[model samples]
Target: MAHRSASGSDRSPHPGRSLAGQLQHLDALRRAMARRHSLNPADMRLLWLLSDDRARTFREISEELNLEQSTVNRQVNSAARANLVQISDDQPARLVLATKEGIAAFDQDVDRSLNGYRQALERMGTEHTAEFNALLAEFIEAYRDIVQPDEEP
Candidate 1:
């Protein structure tokens, strides 16, 4: 009978490495799908931003995202052409608002993307699922702090 290696050092999957790879892969897939849907990641973000507010100006989005005005303007124009959003001249600011279809699309995409993660969690058992979420949440917080930092009220 053949015997397997009992040594713990042989070949074991590193949870950290696996999770990192999965996160990178998922992010890439999301970006690719966004492009395929005739929207970029920034466009999706713009949709989300406008979903709540009736409108916002290029300057507002630029400041919020820390992107240049020209870059944000171009993204808005592209989204506008796709009918995912509409821009209008308003008193407060140049209004940028998501169309009804755009809102629905964003909602659907979010559900679809999260569904896979939900399934994986279900299969991972309760204890592991909780641990995984905690780790992922920690990483998310760290990332947000790195990118956005602490903003004063």
Candidate 2:
């Protein structure tokens, strides 16, 4: 059944649109944070995983991130070109390791991101930050309950 807003405009799918808008806002925030940092978050994520100086095979990274092997290879190649990581010389594992440069980049990105997050939390105030945290947790749980059943193994 179609529903009308206060202005009598039909808007049955409004809730769906609102949910999509929230997701879009999250994406925009990520992009903005990326821009404010030395490395984009996507690249930073890979560097973060390897920050312990542990070399991992592409398959390991792919499985860990639930990404395809080819996609992981592409990301690794990009990072290598930027001198952020190194691919092992033809070996069974063909392990990928983060460079010292990569570690520095990751540290910079984390610093910038944390500064932004801290300022945002300060603006939200203690009570509001706590309330928002609880509400966000509840939303995630509710949304997961609604969506997880259809997900594949």
Candidate 3:
């Protein structure tokens, strides 16, 4: 049986179609987050990594963030210029640490992001939200197994 979507288009029951729709929705959510939040995803991830206040070398950050060394260097340079983070001059390996401004910015962004999630969860209800969370985790693990199989077991 064929079902019509909101725009009067046929919604197929094929698994591929369903998966594609879900992926599209996820991408849209990512875009929305980037638009609404002050920081882009790359910057946000870097900041969160440094949020622990533990200084890490450029190579360590590049590996941790799964970003190229050049990209990491550029971001670190940008952040340093913004005064959001600091780079140490400790000999051979300089470490990057989040400054007070960086922490404050991250905290504010977290609150905003949390509130968005909170509102959505409230509308989804406790049971549905829990189920969604479980499925999302499972989906991520399954996808990772397919792509990042060479990494961690």
Instruction: Tell me the TM-score of model 3.
Output: 0.81
Question: So what's the TM-score on candidate 1?
Answer: 0.69
Ranking by TM-score: 3, 2, 1
Which prediction has more favorable lDDT, 1 or 2? 2
Would you list the C-alpha lDDT of every candidate in the order shown? 0.78, 0.87, 0.88
| Tens digit of per-residue lDDT, candidate 3, span 44-96 | 88899999889999999999998899999999999899888899997599999
For model 2, how does the per-residue alpha-carbon lDDT over 1-153 read when each residue is reduced to its tens digit? 788999999977667788799889988996888887878655887998999888999999998877898989999999999999999978888999999999998998898888887899999999999998899899888788788967653
Best by lDDT: 3
Q: How many pairs collide in each candidate, listed in order?
A: 0, 0, 0
Ranking by lDDT: 3, 2, 1
Per-residue lDDT tens digits for candidate 1, residues 76-153, read 998888888888885667878889878988877766667866887899999999998898789888878877888532
Where is model 3 poorest over a 10-residue stretch in terms of lDDT? 34-43
What value of lDDT does candidate 1 attain over all alpha carbons? 0.78
